[model samples]
Structures are given as structure tokens and as C-alpha cells.
Target: MNRIIAFLLLMTFCSCDFIEKKKVYSNDILDEELKTFNWNDVDEYPTFESCNSNLDNANKKKCFENTLRQILNDKLAKYEIIVSEEINDTVQLKITIDSQGTFVINNIVSNEVTQTEIPQLDSLLRKSLDSLPKIYPAIKRSQEVKTQFVFPVIIKIE
Candidate 1:
């Protein structure tokens, strides 16, 4: 009876080893597959109409930034806001471009002074952003991906 019990225990242990081996092999295969996969990195950055002339990646990025800044500056100039005291503040705008090349305002961050002093600031900014032209969405491995961009506007009341 003792011999029978020992044989049964040995068989159970061997079956467990087989199950563990299968799991180990499957995990190894998955790891190897994961290493071969290409993760999401932008192959091409988002572009503006003015940036289309630049063929180089770095030049395209620079042109896009310059054009965007110019557009924002131009649009903001249309709004007339007066400050009683000379103040300096920075407004950070988080903008997102969807895969379909639609602009979406994610968030706007500013100091308390800007919020309180410039009551119409939010609406003005939104209007300025809404006036912008459509942008080309970023590409990741030939697939268009939604991208987020942060723009900081420095406001100085002289």
C-alpha cells in the first residue's frame, strides 16, 4: 500500500512538470513575438499647409511651428483687451488633432491673474483656435494617429 501511494505521488508531480513546461514555452514565444512588434512612434509629424513645402522632417516641424505661431498671433490681435496694470502671464493651450484631422481643444491652463483679469480670455482663445485651418494628422507606421500639441502664449501688458 505504501508503494502504491508513492507511485501515485510521483505521477502527479510529473504531470505538473509537463504543464509548467508548456506555460514556459508559450511565454517565451510571446516574448519573442513582442520583441519583433513595432511600437507606436510617429513616422511623420502633423503638418500645416505652409509646412507642405518642406520635404525634410526637421524643416517641416520648424515650418509647422512657425506657421502655427503666426496664425495664433494674428488671430489674437483681433481681440481688444485692456489691462489696468502692466502684467505678464503665460497661457498654455493643449490642442489635439484627431485621425480625421479635426482640431479639439483639450485644456487651457493659466495663472489666477489671467483668469480673473482677462475674463473673456477663454472665449477669445477658443475663437482664435477655431479660426485655424485643418492640419494633417500624424502618421505612425503608415497609420494616421491622433496627436496632442502644447502651445504656450506669453501675454505682456505694457
Candidate 2:
């Protein structure tokens, strides 16, 4: 009876270790699988109607920026506001394009002077953005995904 009890105790401890090791091994496998997945790269960058002319990623990005800049500059040129002091400021725009090719302005960040002097800055930006034609959303692994863009608009008042 004593020998049999000792044998049963040993089996219980060994079985517990085996079960623990199996759980640990399973978790390690999951971690390894996740590491192998590519999470950083998108198959295609976001594109504007005018940018679609270039199939190259770098060229597409440049075209998108230039097109957006031209449109915004044209709209901003309509406003003639003189600041008290010579000032150079940057307006940060956070824009998001949804998978359905809808543009959403996430946020606009600017200096106090820009906001105070140009109270209509936000609305003006919205209007400029609204004038943009439909955009093609970014693609990740053959699936269209919502992408966010942070663009800076430089404001110089002398």
C-alpha cells in the first residue's frame, strides 16, 4: 500500500507538470505566429483622383500632397488678413479617409494667433477639404483600410 501511494503521488505531480508545459508551449506558439504576421506595411498608399496617374507609391504620395497643397493655397489666397506682428505659424490637420472613400477631418491644431485672428480658420479649412474630389482609400493586404494623414499648412503673415 505504501509503494502504491508513492507511485500515485509521483504520477499526479508529473501529470501536473505536463499540463502546465502544454499550456506554456501553446502560448509560445501563438506568440510566434503573431510575430510572423506583417503589421507595419500597407499594400498601397492612399490616392487622390489626380494622384491616380502614378502607379508608383512614392510618386503617388507626392502627387497627393501637391494636389492638396494647391487646392488649399487657392482657397487661402482668397483671405487677406494682416497680423499686428510678423508671424509664421503652422496649422496641423489630422485627416482620415474611410474605407468607403469618405474624408473626415479628425482635428485641426494651430497657434493662438491663428485661431484668434482668423476665427474662421476651421470653417475655411472644412470648405477647402470639402472641395476635394473623392479619394481612394489605402489598401492593406488587398483590403481597403481607413488611413489617417497629418498635414501641416504653413501660415506666414508679415
Candidate 3:
């Protein structure tokens, strides 16, 4: 499942322990520039969500559930097919999820110098990412405010 997240930052030389530690404080980029883009806006007050009536108890629950459902649905195939295996090799990857929820191949965070040694696994991992979708729905306040969320991906050996 994590394999599909191609934008994973890794350090092969570093232990999984380091990855765990860094997950908490290594890179600040995701914290600083991990911003959602709002291409254009109108001069007047917001009117988009005005008509989006508040979701009542049942509706609100559905609204939130639907958001997660949509994410899982979009990535289910990738989650199903792409495989990860524990090999004597490691690589780092930085994945970015756009406003639309597309996984961008940002950077390779690898402790391995040559991929030829683990070609088959490398190929399989990369192929799985093809199924990842970029459709992250922004959290709505009163119903409208799309923000960015950064999630880390780890291609664990299963």
C-alpha cells in the first residue's frame, strides 16, 4: 500500500529507526512549503459554500465518510496489485500529493547507489505508483477551504 506512495523520503544508510525519528523532525519542507494552491479568487465575499447547506447529523457523517471512501476508492487498485518485498536493498523517495490528490514523484531518498542490483523490485515498486491518484479533497469549513495535507510513504517489506 505504501509502495504506491512514490513520493517517499528515505535513507537506506539510515536505519528504520532513523526513518521513524525523522518522520517526526527530519524534513521541514513538508511543513513549510507543503501548501495547497488556490489559483484564482474573486473580489467579493465567498458565495460558493453558502448554498452548500450544513450537513445534518446523518448528512455530516456521510460527508466525512464519503471523503475517506473517495480516497480509498481512488487508490484501491494500486493498493491491491503493487507488491513490496523485503530485499537486501533500500531506496528513498519523496512523494507529493497535489490539491487534486495526484502523487508527484518529488525526490528519491535512497541509501542504495545502484538500482541495477535490485532491478526487478525497483521496477515493480515504480509500476505500482501508476495507480495512485491525486484527488485529496480539502477540508471544508462551513463547507469551503481547501488546504494541503502531507503524508509520508514507506515501501515496507511485506
| Residue 85 of model 2, lDDT score | 70
- Total clashes in model 3, counting residue pairs 3 or more apart in sequence or in different chains: 14
Candidate 2 Cα misplacement greater than 4 A, ranges: 1-34, 37-40
C-alpha lDDT score of every prediction, in listed order = 0.81, 0.83, 0.41
Q: List model 1 lDDT by residue over 1-158, tens digit each.
A: 99999999999988886777433588898899879765645677788876765477778777777887888789989877898766699889898889988888788898988888888888888888786776888887688989887878888877
Q: What would the per-residue lDDT of candidate 2 be over residues 1-158, giving only the tens digit for each residue? A: 99999999999988886677433688898899888867765667778887765468778877878888898999888977766677688999999889988888899999998888777889988887886877888888689998887999998878
lDDT for position 17 in model 2: 64
**Residue 65 lDDT in candidate 1:** 75
TM for candidate 1 is: 0.73
Weakest lDDT window of 10 consecutive positions for candidate 1: 17-26
Each prediction's RMSD over C-alphas, in Å, is: 6.7, 5.8, 26.7
Error of 2 at 55 (Å): 2.9
How many residue pairs collide in each prediction? 0, 0, 14
Lowest summed-lDDT stretch of 10 residues in model 3?
A: 42-51
Candidate 2 lowest-lDDT run of ten: 17-26
* Candidate topping lDDT: 2
Residue 51 in candidate 2, Cα distance off native in Å = 1.7
TM-score of each model, in listed order: 0.73, 0.73, 0.31
